[model samples]
Target: MTAGILAIDFGGTRTRVGWYSNVLELITREESLSHTEEPINAVIDRIIQLAQKVVPDCEVPSAIGICAPGPQAYTGYIRYAHTLPTWDNIPLAQRISAAFSNAPTFMENDANLAALAEYQFGAAQGADPALYLTVSTGIGGGAIIGGQLFTGWRGLAIEPGHIKFPAKDGKIYSLEALASGTGIGRLAWEKLAASNTPSSLRQIDTVDGKAVGEAAMQGDALALEVITEAGRWLGLGLVAMVHLFNPQVIVIGGSVVNLGELIFAPARQTLAELLIDPLFNHENLLKVAALGDDVCLTGAAIHAQKMLAS
Candidate 1:
């Protein structure tokens, strides 16, 4: 019999389930809408039903692992998830374990799982002490030290997006509030509306990061200005993290990374400018994540394997 572990990647928009053996092979793939408005138990039941359909022949998985949006307990319970409603203080691990009965279940924040995936198989492979940053709808961060997920006391370490950035107005704002995708969109909308910047983006009415990228690529000066501002903020946030951890590698991921050099070039330049030590200025220390979408499932399998070993 082929031994395998079941993995679930639960996001705000969709839920994905798959199985993995030694290599992170996809046995089956199933997705369901993440109904954030519904109660936590209702969402759990939907996920369980979907998992049952995919692995009907398997009696029990070696273990079950979940990657969820968090404020979750380091040990297992979910304290709160911003994307999902009313999930505060829910015993998520216990509920999932009850569903399996025989199999052990484990859960971690999605960003942490992404970091684990990078450490085990992706950009951070062979790099001890690495950091992963996902800059998308919202910014999320995770870190691994000596090949172990560095979840600090109560598992809430490496939340880099929450770090404050000094503003020109003499007040400070969080990286998420200034540089996240949503923040970029809001900034573009406000700036374009307030000024007579002659650009295609202004005609569209609805502004988003994708639109901002497209405009920048098309040589819209205002778009380039806005994106550079976001990149600068992101770099400033990473500077704090780099000083604190001094990780060997930093992996940048998520939808916003699609901006590619438009974002990364400015971010790298700004980071180098802010670093105080000449020792920290180096190439190959930072790179984009290579695993893409399968990262969470891969990390979940790794988490399950660790649980089995423990």
Candidate 2:
């Protein structure tokens, strides 16, 4: 019965749809496995159906905001997403908007939306130039500048995860390959196979970045070592980001963020060890997301609001 927003945060493995008031308060939401393996049309159908359940009785939402993976909404075309190979040619914003009485639609990469959410309502909280990193299965990030989301060059800028690194295993690696959650789990297994070191990770049934953090919390030497190594790489990536953007505030979020200071401490050390000059002046320049798991969803609403105001 209310005219609000239908916000969608679409990821590789999950798709979240939320109902929010025009003022940006979440009223309800639904989550589902993305099932990208299915036909592309079916995936879109499911999202539309979920919207029906959450936004009850509204003939049309005031607006719609969609945060999808990979390329931005430039021309409403998704250029690439390894997880969504079939989505490249579709004008997603137009399609979704058409579904809701052609409600005004805004779309962007999930990381960009997350940064906007933080800048407007969460940790960044009005910092002039802010940056956000979501270091989960992979590292994804975006930036905010002059109190607005800085989605440069067709909304393709600020992909901090892909920062370059020296060649490894006959191919050059990016920051995500070395410092993200997936990278942490991969490193743990590589270490387990290569070293005779004793650690609690050997006892876990499934070892992921989360398990590594739990093990490290329990004082496991190898687990702690693996975290430190990942943190150092993460720090190296941060150093690169700092130099590139000189952001006033940097907010780190996502599953890997739960690794907490065990990772950040070393990242900070690396920042101190490298970096020709100091840049941070804001208090807690690097910190966890205040909004937690729902950052992207909140961001979707923020995007919707921004689009409405414009």
TM-score, one value per model: 0.94, 0.92
Task: Give one digit per residue, the lDDT tens place, for model 2 in 164-189.
Answer: 88744676788887888788888899
Runs of candidate 1 with Cα error greater than 4 angstroms are none
Please write out the lDDT profile of model 1 over residues 205-296, one tens digit for every residue: 67898888789889899998889888888888878888888878899999888888888887888878988895775798779999998788
* True lDDT of residue 292, candidate 2: 75
User: Which TM-score value belongs to model 2?
Assistant: 0.92
- Cα distance off (Å), candidate 2, residue 42: 1.6
Each model's RMSD to truth, in Å?
A: 1.7, 2.1
> Against the true structure, candidate 1 has what lDDT?
0.82
Give lDDT: candidate 2, residue 259: 77
